[model samples]
Target: MTTMTPPVTPPVTALNALGFDRPAADTRVVVAMSGGVDSSVVAAMLAREGFDVIGVTLQLYDHGAALGRKGACCAGRDIHDARAVAARMGFPHYVLDYESRFRESVIDDFADQYLAGATPVPCVRCNQRVKFRDLLATARELGADCLATGHYVRRIIGARGPELHQAADPARDQSYFLFATTPEQLGYLRFPLGGVATKAETRAMAAGFGLDVADKPDSQDICFVPQGGYAAVIEKLRPGAAEPGEIVHLDGRVLGAHRGVIHYTVGQRRGLNLGGGDPLHVLRLEPESRRVIVGPRAALGVARLRVAEVNWLGDGAFADAPPGGWRAQARVRSTRPPAPARVLPEGADTA
Candidate 1:
């Protein structure tokens, strides 16, 4: 039997229908422009709405040396485009040098996670450390009331305080990556394109505003990995982390050799060179033994997970004062849906 899919709605119509109004002329907002169409449109819309808008782009990395030619929207050309858009829209623009901070927070954490045999979500860390945390601080320093981004997620402040909702455009909803945002940060954050439904619509709006990046393609790869591959970056940071290792079966029988432990992740099936019988999946990586444990797919199901460095949204939700523990939705990874969970304080470092 075929299942019917839900109808998709654009963020613009939904947000307007929800009665989200623009700020007044005296209200100030700082837009994080990344030389992308969505951010450009956001700045233009806010400016047109008569709010005091200031555009800021974070120079997070050495894009010229990394990308070789420097024509992309993430680095060199993107900065120029952002400045041009700000000029055209009659808003003040500034570029913040955040390369050292980005490297320390994002790049180092990424390498450390791979080294630790766990998949790290760098985007979440970036948002937590740089965008929401650092950028929001900068906004406040500039005396702005709010900071805005092009992220496709809606912030709703209700009786229970601030709750993040999926964007009206489900395909473009970025709520997953934003799970790390604390309740305090959500209060000062705004996602103008959270209500936008499609890339086509964003581009159309940009074109209407005569923005330079109207036809620019959305960046598909991580900004740091210019070639769209991370293996090289991993090798560069940890020289011997990708050395060859033995691939063993769950029963302790030797199978084949793997290029490296960093090359694999949980629930991966492809590129395992064990002679074909039933398909095999990576169950675990024994870093100490330099061995990769392969098994059938059933071994991948994990009902319980211990997440450290927990950031609770509500007061005392993770404290010891709870009778039955706090009940809320928990998400381990950003892309996955938040599962029902009973949160208990496992101490500061334990979570």
Candidate 2:
């Protein structure tokens, strides 16, 4: 009888959340620490997994001014909390002073957009220019194979490389603020906590790791905008920015006086100070004439609107889509789900 030999099994390589098929010690990862519960949990989880992790916190605003400012990120307390988490996790940490860069990249742009009679999303701008853009570069220079964040957005490996998706927990989904994450940035970035079910789960994880920030409050406002006020900051940055303007009704009647067009936004209803027969809403802001144009709720409805600076991330090019345009899901605002949309390119710059 001939002896039979069993076939040998190939070694199974395990992949970490950062997607490296090697021991965590050999793969270096940079975690953007905000000293909040979510980010602190991310760093702690990676550290617990025996990864070679380096924690980096960005001081994006004035340290002195940010003291005792609760519910704000990238401030003095946040930096301290990040350092504490790193100490507990036994990982090296760094604090980068990015105040000037943030002001020019995000804060200034935010004020300018408001002055131009448009609502601005500074969180998106910060992610686009400061974190995903500048900070991602810093990670590469530090020899980090990947940069991980605590953001609530998913990155799935698809046929066409990495594809961005909403977080598993829809309530905590932050895909809107991250829509501008370029393909290149998406390739180098990872979100470890995106798959987690809820904030309570994150807090539990933080407690397990002995991180002090386990109970830290989530940041509620723009880090640079103290007490939820950006108008004052804008006025200080750009002297004479809040010039008086007229609030005019859609029917060409002057309704009231507005301090400035910057004080209002499209579709705003509150603080109009109009003694009216029926409730009115702001339809649009005319920056050219510094006017806040109001109308009935019907006028605020829009069948279509122009969106500029398109960033294409879907499969295939725009021209490859059907003649009528790509059948896709899109959201006009973050509060709503992406409904059915027929995206057609209006020009080179907009859709």
> Candidate 2 has what TM-score?
0.95
Model 2 steric clash pairs: none
Cα deviation at 264, candidate 2, in Å, is: 0.5
Residue-level lDDT of model 2, residues 41-101, one tens digit each, is: 8999999888889999998888677678776887888888999999988999999989899
lDDT of 1 by residue, 179-245 (tens): 7798888888888787777878999999999987898878666788766567678888889888788
Worst-scoring 10-residue span by lDDT in model 2: 341-350
Q: Estimate each model's TM-score.
A: 0.86, 0.95
Tell me, by TM-score, which candidate is best. 2
Runs with alpha carbons beyond 4 Å of true place in candidate 2 = 1-12, 347-349
Candidate 2 Cα deviation (angstroms), residue 125: 0.8
